[model samples]
Target: MAKEATLQVRMDADLKEKAEALYRDMGTSFAEAVRIFAKQSVQENGMPFAMTANRKNTYGRLSGYANTKLAAEEDGAYEREMVGKHEKTD
Candidate 1:
């Protein structure tokens, strides 16, 4: 085998710990699992699973709850005017 290279990724600390524990239960280290995924992706020429979700419009969907407040914004200002439900602020 050729010399191995390091791959660094940063994520939420809690999520990383959860993933590590799950991989341990499955009898594989996180790095080993990532290697298997990389090899499979290379052999398949792309992701080996279907991604049917509309991920490109993600910000639109994610911000829907704040749409009314954001509607009044111009040039991209979105400061909240209400402190909570049924509560208005000065």
Candidate 2:
């Protein structure tokens, strides 16, 4: 017999409910989806998906902007605000 490990994650309640519903509609539970992701990542030796930055968010506004530094700072501030807003609280 193989030993099993438990994984714990904290996420927003609404996000968790939405993900669970999505996976259930796909004929699997969210936990199973996570297992599938882990197995695929192991087989691929890394993420099983490609990641790309959103070009509009990353560069579109900066085009011909006089102060790129300020633009980047504003972007960072916005990201931080969003993260704080969505972070789970116990």
* Estimated TM-score for each candidate: 0.55, 0.56
Per-candidate Cα lDDT values, in order, are 0.68, 0.77
Which pairs clash (backbone N, Cα, C closer than 3 Å) in model 1? none
Please provide, for model 2 over 6-81, each residue's C-alpha lDDT reduced to its tens digit, 9 standing for 90 to 100: 8998867997999999999999999999999999999999867653344455344435433668666787787788
How far residue 29's Cα lies from its native spot in candidate 2, in Å, is 0.2
Residue 64 CA error for candidate 1 (Å)? 14
* Residue 40 lDDT in candidate 1: 92
lDDT of 1: 0.68
Write candidate 1's Cα lDDT for 44-83 as tens digits: 9986554434545644454543445546654243333333
Candidate number achieving the greatest TM-score relative to the actual structure: 2
